[model samples]
Target: MRQPMIDTYEEAIEAVRACGILPLAPLIPDHPSLSGITLPERWHSDTELDPWRWRVRFPGDGIAAYGKFMKKKAILVASDLVPSVRSLLGSSRSIAQRYGDGLISKAAKEVYAIIEEEQGIETRALRAAAGMKAKESKKEFDQALAELQSGFDIVISGVRAPRNEAGEVNGWNSTCFETVEHWMEGAGIPLAPMSADEARSRLQARLGEHSSPQAMAYFAKVFGF
Candidate 1:
């Protein structure tokens, strides 16, 4: 089911358009950045996925940064980078199984079953066991959180650039944070940072039971407060 690898950035863009996922990269003078960076006039396309929302993938560290960006967008497919077998049998699946069985919920199991069947391994007991174990671990939530944190850290550090002439970032710029904050505001998520006591009070009001101060602190820490 893997598509042929596209050699050029233009080909990749066309492929992404067909797949309905936006391709974005960081800005560079001689390179392309996906979000908010100006493009060469001749490179524009009429694709459904906006070029402005695409990312730049230069050589070296650019791939890492691009991966971080994709994670932020919730569209990074591990299967795209490595063989599906690697991703299916790797830490990603284990992590999914760890946090909550819900990570490998029924839908995921169905998908796995289909993949197994296609690979002629549907009756393989060992494969079945492995899938079940992954479900049991529920590690996906923690892994997903870790991935998000890394991307958030990258964004916050101003490392991925909409850079200046000397290659210095003009100011604190985070496309991912901006996108999330925008979404939250539109969804009516509160912008206020609550203190431990305040959060406890809010939780009590909502659930009729207060979370412990330690729990609130833990929540705050996890959420980057």
Candidate 2:
């Protein structure tokens, strides 16, 4: 079946608002996605209409969040629904609590501390600041980042290239990371505390209305609702 087409930012945002959650790729069942709805030529056009670029812009626009929050895939979640989503699948517990409780790894704690202190940072710089710069730490660093994103402790804010000492661009553009709370605050949204069960019920209700039974079942398992 043909997916509904979306060529511009406005149209895509409208579709996403209607659906609430959109995968960056074509992974979601019975739903529109950024890549799925967009034409292939538009992937990295280096223009305002690029879907690839939109992933970074969307979060800063204060309308939604862009992160690998579900199934370890990039997804854009509606701004208002984030608190609920985090409540259901993410930890509201502090890094200290989660680390102490053995819910997150030592590397995860080290990485998150830098993120919390800096408010946001690039992946390469974050690795350095967290003191995980050794070649062997690459895999563990990545896993820590993924773990934090999966737990909604952090999110990708945007894309940018770091600078060299001489003030020139250092390398290729990299994704920026920020605490979910900071991201929400920057967007003027609050990361309110809530009941996980309540969040699940609300999310299930919303998904049930907009998605199929089969999709709902799939989400229930994937997101652990």
Candidate 3:
């Protein structure tokens, strides 16, 4: 598939809302890579035909415009499709079952709890709140965060760029995390109640059209389809 160039933030938002789901980049394992990806890079710096400009621009801009950001199947998903996706993937009961079965690690639980208490927090603030601020524990902290994301418990809701004394933006943007429910509410997105089996079946049918059987199975495992 040919990669699309999104020249403006409005264009990026329109693309995401339409797609319902997309990779943070233009990566499809089975396809040839003619160009790189979008959002995190400079918006108009596509001196070449790469999509980095669109990739870097989408996540933060989408969140502000009307979208949710979560690690879906290890890739970032910024879309209005989150409410339906979450409903299909897991419910409160399923999540509770995972916790009761000890599938959720102590560190992940701690990290999740902090985010729940604070509503929405930046990564650094989350680390401090979870008391995993030590350098050596960084890996554990990262893993815990990823675990939460993979389980569909939390998401990167926004990004924060610090401003200098003169009011100029400085440094890379820090990601802000929030519970899936909180994120939905903040974005004014609504969740439609759907049975887990129905949701999974719909997802499988949609993805199976484009993916190999093996890839479909991998997606099922990753997304809890």
- Inter-residue clash pairs, candidate 3: 37-51, 37-52, 38-55, 38-56, 39-54, 39-55, 39-56, 39-57, 40-55, 40-56
Q: Quick one: best lDDT, which candidate?
A: 2
218: Cα error in model 3, Å: 7.3
Per-residue lDDT over 7-86 for candidate 3, one digit per residue giving the tens place of the 0 to 100 score: 45565555454443455544444421213324445534644433443344444443422222234333444444465567
Worst lDDT run of 10 residues, candidate 3, spans: 64-73
Error of 3 at 144 (Å): 0.6
Model 1 lDDT per residue over 80-182, tens place: 2212211111233332353356543443344333333332122223234434436554464334333533332112111133457898866543332222222
Kindly list the per-residue Cα lDDT of model 2 for residues 57-168, writing each as its tens digit.
7898987888888878888988878888888778767899988999899999999899898876888889999888899989999999889989888989998887988999
Q: Give the winner by lDDT: 2 or 3.
A: 2
Question: Which of 1 and 2 is ahead in lDDT?
Answer: 2
Best by TM-score: 2
- Tell me the whole-model lDDT of each prediction, alpha carbons only: 0.32, 0.83, 0.59
For candidate 2, the TM-score is 0.93
Off by over 4 Å in 3: 1-3, 30-80, 94-97, 162-172, 201-225
Over 4 Å off, model 1: 1-33, 38-103, 115-225
Question: On a 0 to 100 scale, what is the lDDT of residue 221 in model 2?
Answer: 85
